[model samples]
Target chain A: MDEAAIDVRGLSKSFGGRTVVNSIDIRVPKGRIFGFLGPNGSGKTTTIRMLCGLLTPDGGEGTCLGMDFRTQAEKIKEKVGYMTQKFSFWEDLTIRENLEFVANVFCMNRVSERVEKALKGLGLESRADQLAGALSGGWKQRLALAACILHEPEILLLDEPTAGVDPKARREFWDELYRLSEAGLTVLVSTHYMDEAERCHEIVYIAYGDLMAKGSVEEVIAKTKLKTFRVGGKNAAKVREALEGNPAVATTALFGEDLHVSGTDGEALKRLIAPQASENGLSLDEVPTSLEDAFIYYMNRAKEN
Target chain B: MFSRQRIKGLIKKEFIQLKRDRPTLVMIVMIPVVQLLLFGYAVNTDPKYLPASVILRDDTFLTRSIVSALERSEYFRIAGAVFSDNAGDARLRSGKDMFVITFPDGFTADVVRGKAPSVLIEADASDPTSVSGALGALQGIAESVIAKELKGPLADLAAVRPPFSFTVQKKYNPEGFTRYNIVPGLIGMVLIFTGVMMTAMALTRERERGTMENLLSMPARPFEIMVGKICPFIFIGFFQSGVILFLARFLFGIPVLGSGGVLAAALLLFITCNLLLGYLISTAAKNQTQALQMSIFVLLPSLMLTGFMFPFYGMPEWAQYLGSCIPLTYFLRIVRAVMLKGAGFADVAPNFWSLTAFVAIITLITMKAYKKTLD
Candidate 1:
């Protein structure tokens, strides 16, 4: 079998007597576009750090690219390009200068050629002379990615790289990620955006230091077994609030004029909503549960369990 | 190939970073130039214009001649009036004057009768400079005026011939030129103060901006990054020191009495210590503001205790002990010894080793303390 890009289990980390990343299992096959889904402060960054050998887990064993993690951090670092969540490149340098510096840091033999290729690859050649600080959010994001990938490592660990980027830029970034994955780079990106999550080949949902679920999108949805109902026509807010606290209802969110109500207790939810829909002159219909409802069910169940 | 490639690449990156950073560039160049000119010219502590108070109690012709002689010596500017009633005690207590000379009260009859009465001169011993000048002036006036009068009175009598003149010798910077002492010491101090303070906030600023995390994730090892960071500053320090030393020689006429080779070695040692110190400061500080504050606390005591502003001997006993422990203090001594006294290897060896030890200890601590985590 091809070597797994990242393979780990029983990972735990504590900070000042509080565990931030409890014993958890994580695996990403070679060249897969893997997504880690989590809310803020949800151990995602901690896991990424451990996997890239930037941090050593208190209790864990793992290998990245078939190399021992503890002894081979330098090797892993050499093989992976990590893009941090924040804009981290020196703002004083121009795009060209920033790329040249990164190339030097890697100590590439043909630095000029490498810098030229990275600039052109990122479509930043036009603005190569522009100060990195002057570049807009999108272009700056592109520049950061360019610097990270200049040395062309086998794996990329991007920590919420698209947090504040506009949609167009986010799309372009995702497109670049896909192209890199096609060229045999394993991209382990952590993102909160559902659309971004949907683009990944596989997804892992983590909450409060535990991996809640992991699989292909379809398999994860099937595992959730969430039955959803859409109730629409004016007064959706009142309906959403009314269905919110019901024991049978797992989650309720208002989608504009409609209320997307979901629960694992399909029969009880149907009984609870049938009478209200008829009396309020609203339409009630069965709808396919999306990743949103499945995630919500998993979150609610995780909370209870 | 690998080593050559890396070193060349790293040096290029360092220069690029240096070029982009304008404020740091300005500060490094400006502080030394301004300090050399300001302190070299304005801070004249070389013992001239001493204040003297005269008690002209005697109305004799010889005493009058003595008083006129005192006035003729420009070294002793008459700060206090010619008090008649021996008010020396109050004048000394108020600290308004440095010296009070009280000539004995007698008519010209006592001197003509060959009594050979003496005069009392009280000098403020608080300021060493004041006391030293006052004492020299007093000795000079008494011998000359007394010899002139005694020549007429006792030229025929050689039986009681006493020594008529006094000899004076100056120690440690004999001419007492500020540049000879200060510039040499300044070479040590300015290298450290600017070198460490400028590079102190380097990594921390990047860390605060969240750039360190990205850099950490890169393929480069920590040692590689560190060398790349410090090598450029070392070159800059060397260049700046050369300019300041040249300027001191050409513009201020400060002589480097010591061997240029030894001075160069001492300066190199000082720069390494400073670079290590800057790295340690950067490693320890959590943010740029903390780094800036820490630099102040480190450098202020460093400059003050190194005897840059005050002689090491002038400090209190405890302060002297503290000064001995600081590397800058020892380095300052070595620089001045070599550049002013023309000291050699035997002279600066102990200083060199002590600085080397300090650099080694701090570098180990910095290496151990710095971790690749946000926490």
Candidate 2:
């Protein structure tokens, strides 16, 4: 954590008299891609909104890039580039024109030169004259990012930048993010993809307006404290049905040909699954808990709370 | 309040966006000129040509002479002179022609006996203002011609019809010229055209596609954004105002009775108020469609309630009270009062204060609402 580029505590937000983001704390270091992961309505965007100084938290004190968020919002704004979930750009304007418009907003010196540099940076030189609306989803995203970074902000806040892109395209985007991070731009990105989460330097999982876990991807999976077992047989479906609703069973998910199950009390889970395994002639063995399993376990726990 | 550099950046950005939309800019200027022409030429209060039917019940020489004279007069056109002895009076109730002249069955014998012949002029009172003037003016010509004819026949004419009177004072425009009134009010419309079309598209655009968050996070304050958004419109608005004034003076030859400097100052205030109002609408709308619709809804009501079509003086008591609340109504009134009535600054001081307060209050509200962004 290099000087805690984003250090915040007890952040809370409310709208229409209901708390959307409750008391939460997050600390992100410089030059790292921090992934905010959670289900829909889990306050990931709201928390991101607060951290970037795009919004003021009702109850929080934080510094973004070593500036006080409440008082120095203008200063923080000058340093951060935020990519929203939605595609927002003038559809009528060409790619070059859109970049120029953003540059105008920043009032940067030598605007035409900066436009050339941004066009080259995003690999948008070939299509600079094309209308923004004519481009497909990936290109629109590239344009939005180019607009955000034209002023060369120190940090970038991406709210689900790769939501609908294909996996290959998503990989290409992450590569660009890694390159930007290596150049000393702190990144705070939110995504639900497990593999994408693993690529992050650290992960913060939030659910139901509460911060559930924060650590490296491997550490988060280990901290779930779940003992999982995999049952594979021709009658795995029947085994899943019988094991479900059992007090000892925490989760039962169909994974291709096998039924994966988990429970916090390992002894009780073993006792329950052993009988079902023998009756169905299914082979049972302890399995390494994947991130998806840990996520599901944590999500179900959040629901019961 | 914001830093000087940040405010400058916002202003520059706003100008760039404004330069992008051209069709809307054309519409703003077009609506005002079209409205001015529609109101100026189409709206005529003076009676130009009234259709008057004469039902001559008398077949005497004097009645024939009176009928011939009424036909030749410019005040009324003789549509049809039906013999009262032929068709019944049922046609009179159908409102065919404004006035009917019915002379009694005197024959020319009453004039020879030196007794004055009495003729009845029944006028249609449906639209009392329009036909009443024609009725009053026609009677003057008929009476003067009859008095001359009677003066030769009778020596003492003391008891003769005491000269039917025509008392008409055409207020505002004695010549009934269109350019006089329309040119003054067109100035206000031009301001609205330029100010509203520019500022209305600004904030909603950012919010519609999710770029507003990025802007809010920028080093720009809400008031700074607002000022930036309106500055470009103000310049355009003033330029349009100048064009309208030039058209009025050079093309139409309309007199600038009021202080040109004072008129320009009032126009600035009007445009400022319009920009502020546009900003308020933008903040209220979630998208461009919503903003555009709401602007129309507001613009239409303002065009009506602001006394653009009907005169504030001629309208009923309730309408005049409603007209006073509309900003455009007050602005138009001040512009017209200054340009047409030659009203000084002291006369228009109240209107200036009202516009100043309206712009100030709306601008403050938008600024306060914009500053309250949430996590």
Candidate 3:
């Protein structure tokens, strides 16, 4: 096992007396893409900010890039490349100018060459002289990524990097992240997209300021202990309506033409679906529990408590 | 230790953005020129052509000569003639005339007999500045005109000077050119405008644009950021002051009598103080609008109470005390003393130290207010 790149305990933050990030712990090994999965305002952004030293946690003790996260935040900042949730670079400046400014701030040697390399690496060489504000959302995200990694820090903390970005751009962005991770850079990205979350080596789910789940995609789904019964028929919606109120059913979601009913108690789920299975023109089949279903089940359970 | 390279980088970035922002750049230069021209032509302490009505009871040549002489003095423009004292007072009260000159019913025989007839002059003194210079000129005009009128047989009366005589010599501004007073004070005004407003918006703009979080997440220190943000505007302040000073010297013919080194030193200190005060405002403001409001909030009091608009010593003791607290008040004194009064470094040392203290205090407060982390 490798040493954890980010190891923190009991991290919490509150804004105006309302806890935005409760006491949560996380540990991610080096060279892994860790995805932060949660609903909006679920402390994903706040936790990412805290981990990268952009924000001070009200209560937390941790190490980032092998330095004390609280007292040695500046030291940690030097080793971490943090890309904000918004396009935070100077919009009026050209792409080359923005990258050059970032490189200069880090006081890197051979700044022009480094900026040129970053521009070329991000496929922004053609638009190097274009103003950042003039770029489309996809181009802006690419430019932001290029600027953040100019110093080549050992850790990358990205806050919703692909938001509002097209699917093609997002796929290309993930491909770049994978390349960075393969080069021994630890990556922690906060995102709401399930596909993006699934691309991560490990994932942590948070809700209402609490850590609901944490593990690999398979491990997280297995831990949910959810048995999902896919119901397909002319009256699949009717089957969803029948099984919704049962104590065995945690969540019932319609996924285009099919209904996925899931619950934690497998025996109860099976017993409830058996009667539905015997109904005319109705068929029930057990399917592999997906990350989305497990997440929904966890979200519903958290809401219930 | 602060990173000089990072500070340089920040300044470079600022200049590039400033080049791109054409409107703000235009404002930076145009505001001072517009203010200079506006205040230069519009503000005059020595008001002329004030409306006056004369009440003549004697209808003597002497009264007519006095009225015409008053008109020729350019201080009084005869609006009309009033028949009674009541009408004269009505004209004064109704804002129709600024002054009422009344000649008593005593005939010209009194002046011919060397009895020294008294002519009463009533002036509206509501706005003291508008009336002060004209009123002061009345005594000289009366003496000269009466002396000239008493010729030949009245030459003895002309020879007899007034019971008490006094001469007023305006040493620095002999002609009472308001530009001489306003142009130097404008340096302070322009500095405050650019220094406070520009620096006030710098950090808040970053925060509003979401770049502040990225800035803080880097390895830069607060001191470095503060210096970087403020250093570029120091040049801007100098650029504005340079334009104003050039105009003051070449265009307005106002002299810079003090040592150039001392004036530059004072200006440097004053500009830094205002820029730091602006930075302090930025740390407290959440956005650019609030920052601009805060800058204006500071500007209003400084402009009103700093003796830039009115005489500093003429203000009440408490207002003077309040004015003394504003950096612009001291800077106005320093710049005016240097440029207008021909003051030396030693003469303006107290104000120099006061501005330095202001810079120190504001820098400390700004640093304390600028938190490294988002709380």
Candidate 4:
């Protein structure tokens, strides 16, 4: 991380007396894909909007692309691309027309060439004449990405860009993102998918209005301090039930015949579940805490606080 | 295949959704209440106090009695006296007076000698229905007043061929066709329909479809977006205006008497005013449905109070003031004056300026209402 592309502090936003994002600080280095993860209404979208100048923070100070995000919003808007969670493009316009409209809005030079390049780059050239509304969810997401990058923005702020896409399409979308990132574009993307989050260089997890966790994928899991054990047995539900009542277990889930139990204190959780595992003639194996489990631990801890 | 429980659940859901839409709920209650008040309080078919300007070359007792009797009849208000017949004609052309009653010179001596002098009564008959009732009342008023004045000797004079004669000349529309008045005013109506209602729904559709958020997130300024959105509708409004003007000219045979440039300029100003007002409505409305409801709310007043359907001066003073505040009122005036009286730019300049002011005011308010941020 040589220099921060997006460096923000005390970024807070509220809607109608309800605080959506509060005092959230984020710093993403240039040319890095920073994942923003949160449950629904966790202010992931709110924070992104504030950074892009689509929303003014109730209380905050930050810089996006080295310009004051608040006061220099117009100038910053020139360099930053924002993709909303919804398909917020003109559906009536064809794919080519939509791109052309966006290119015109940005007042880009050589708009036709730029549009043709974006269409081909997004694999939309074959169906560029189709109305945007007629496209499937996966293709719509791709088109949104193409439109966002049409102006050659330095930073891309995507709010859940792949929320409803098929797995294959999502994989392709991420491949495009990687290409953009490698080409020196800093990306701040919000998503609910854990697999997508793991692909990011670093991630920040927000719960409700607070920043719960922030680090690289492994570092975030390490920060959670959660220990997980895989118990394989026919009595997996029984094992899960017993661990659910105990404070030592942060989260417990049954994956087929195997039960995965996790908690912050490794010693206490092992001590608590070891007897139960042997009593039921179950094999227990310690496993690294997955990001999903770490996130659940953060959520549970936030709820308790 | 419809289950009772499912139907009941759907009905409940619909009601809940409707209740949650506060703007629609408010519109539901306000539309009828306001409509009732407007129809009951403001609308009048047989308009009273039709302003009449007079040029009395014979201001004798008989002529004065005739003028006072016209006022007492309550059909005419007797606005003010003018020195010449040209001034009276000017008042009629400008729509300031509905009638111009002129008493010729030496009318008292001629009447006493049973000369049966001619009294010229010029009526602005562009809006035939509005002036018809007052015009019908004039002869009775003058004859009765003259009969009262020519008492002893005039009883004999009244006995034969009437004491005096008055010729009622209907100006602008000698044929007195109602279509002439309505067809010209239809230009403003069609403009309102497209410019206000359609423009409002178009903007709200963008917001509802979520395209507006995307547009706002771009490098586009609010003013640029507003202009781009409204410019297409402006063309649509002009197209509708052209259609109406074509129909008015061919179908209704309503003469396009004014300069084409003047009418086009007025149409541009009027259409822009309506489109800006629509933008203002869209800024206030949360969705397309609310935008439509608000458009109807604004439209009903323009239709009723702008002298489009009803006589403007016939409404109560407060309603007249309210009507004046609507751009359609000035538009109707300008269009009618231009089409019927062949008025020039100077004739309709006040109305053109009023519409311009409306555009300016609505533009400022819409700018304030339009939030650059989603907040």
Could you give candidate 2's per-residue lDDT for residues B82-134 as a string of tens digits? 77632423333332344566666663566556555556666543234544455
How would you encode candidate 3's per-residue C-alpha lDDT over B1-375 as one tens digit per residue? 999999999999999988986556655776576456434543444756778898888897777887888888877789889899878765554334667887777747777666667777776543345456666887878777766776777677666654212222233455666667678888898889889998999888999889899999999989999999999988988889999888878998887887899889988899999999999999988888778767876786687677687654344456657778899988886787667656677666777888988988888888889988877
RMSD of every candidate to native, in Å, equals: 14.3, 15.3, 14.2, 2.1
* Distance from true location, Cα of B300 in model 2, Å: 5.1
Best by lDDT: 4
Runs in model 3 lying further than 4 Å from the true structure: B1-164
- Candidate 2 residue pairs that clash: none
Q: Which of the two, 1 or 2, has more lDDT?
A: 1
Q: Could you give candidate 4's per-residue lDDT for residues B1-375 as a string of tens digits?
A: 889999999999999999898888898899899899999999988888889998999888888988889899888899989999778877788788889999999988898888888888898889998988887886788678866787775678877777787789999999998888898898999889778887787667888888878887888887887898789887888888888888787878887898889999998899888988888888888888889889998999999999999989788889999999999999998899999999888777888888989999999898888889877
In candidate 3, list every pair of residues with a backbone clash: none
Candidate 2, residue B220: the lDDT equals 70
Preferred candidate (TM-score higher): 2 or 4: 4
* DockQ of every predicted complex: 0.44, 0.36, 0.59, 0.83
TM-score of chain B taken alone, every candidate: 0.58, 0.57, 0.60, 0.95
How accurate locally is residue B308 in candidate 2, as Cα lDDT from 0 to 100? 59
Lowest-sum lDDT 10-residue window in model 4 chain B: B146-155
Instruction: Compare candidates 2 and 3 on DockQ and give the better one.
Output: 3
User: 3 or 4: which has the higher lDDT?
Assistant: 4
Model 3: how far residue B246 lies from native, Å: 2.5
Candidate 2: where are CA atoms >4 Å away?
A278-281, B1-172, B190-198, B235-266, B286-301, B304-307, B315-326, B333-362, B369-375
Q: Which of candidates 1 and 3 is the stronger one according to TM-score?
A: 3
